[model samples]
Target: MELTKEQLAFFDTFGFIKLSGLLKADITWITEEFEAVFPMLEEKHDGSKRTMIVPFADQREKLCSLVDDPRIAGIAKSLLGDDFNYMGSDGNYYTGDTGWHRDGENRARRHVKIALYLDALDGSSGALRVIPGSHRLDDKFGVDVKRVSQSQTALHVAGPDVPAVALDVVPGDVLVFDHNLFHASFGGSTHRRMFTLNLCERFGEDALDELRAYILLHAHFKREHYYGSAMLRSAGPERRVHLEQVDALCGDYAERTKDLPELPLKALI
Candidate 1:
């Protein structure tokens, strides 16, 4: 469904929204796909730390098609325009707590993450928590949180101690949030199932440098291409609209990079 006027406004104002049961029909297959994808990877999650896979949705053709699902596409199209770029995705089995944090440093560009949690969750069970309106970089709340929490020494407290709304969700629900939004999850079991699809506004010719930098980040994934052959092979026109931009520059992404940025200390899924 296309977002209504108020829905758009809420995302713009609060930086996140939860759409319950939007993926209910596909949940069963999504569950199968999630289970199927992990064994392809050599890494095993022993409940010690977060286990992650990049280009997550592409691992299974069914999961890759989620980008074309009307409800999923609508959310991305509504905020990012018809020509949005499909940035990438991540799948995870999270262990312990995820400290409060923002996902990116680009202030001029905006991106949104569509998160799917495959298990029932609450604040104390790894439900996503967010500080509303925190994406407004220049605002007082945004600046203050960034200042105090960037080092965490000034706050001198744990992430869950900070005030915020804990978003409760079930298996079929979906959560969308601005990449700049301050969010975290805590008090969870060792194995929390989750995955995300990321989308962002199309860059203008003048912003190609920024676009290149964003594409370069795929280096950390240890990948030579952004999307998998499955995503590209199955993409129809609408999906192609989102995939074309990234495909232009990712052909030899890994070989081109002299060094990859250090992986995140804590894996974010």
Candidate 2:
């Protein structure tokens, strides 16, 4: 996608953008397709495997095609750099019963999320809550917030005054967010929430390997910050090797995105 100067500037400052109706006719189809392949996620604390299953069987291929859309992936590449990779996908429905947290440590690279809302999302409907521009805080923290899963009561620390933006996502709208941004969603009593996730630029050669390894050994990589419970974490060397193998599949993704023509939003509609 060709990002206007203002759009680019917004992402740099706010850490996310809600692009309306990003799904269109394919919304129901994609959701149904992904649900068919959705696996029961292990209730581990770490962020690994939490988003492992891609709805389409040929997930990597479909992602490449989707990301190549000029209005979508092209802009992602522009902000995230051309070395982007398709790291994982997730389907989430919130109860609004939970509070705040971040996905920093779970992601393997500098991550950005292409969140396509399949249905309307609002506070009452368990819509997403975000700390805008949280992504920009990474450099100051001495750690990439993307890699930090815990900050000891950071949820409470974030407090109530932190302005909570209720996303009014029409079906087909897409939201691009920095993975490190501090955001959370409440659950809906009815209507399932669905979205496609993409992570850009694999920083380390062994990043995927590390993920695969962690998953195999630990079955869960627990992150205590958000859940206030253990989610999942890596374990043992044998699993680490397995993680390496799984990571290999993603290695070529960056190369694939290099020269494609942009997919504009107008064409998508």
lDDT of 1 by residue, 134-222 (tens): 88888887888784354357776767777889999988999999998999888888999999999998888788777777877554555
Instruction: Provide the TM-score for each candidate, comma-separated.
Output: 0.92, 0.60
Give the number of the best model, judged by lDDT: 1
Q: In order, what lDDT does every prediction score?
A: 0.83, 0.51
* Reference-based lDDT, residue 204, model 2: 67
Stretches of candidate 1 exceeding 4 Å from the true structure:
147-152, 257-269
Report the lDDT of model 1 for residue 47.
89
Clashes of each: 0, 44
Candidate 2 versus the native: TM-score?
0.60
lDDT by residue (128-210, candidate 2, tens digit) is: 66777666654563243332234334433333334567676777778888876777665554334555555556456546466
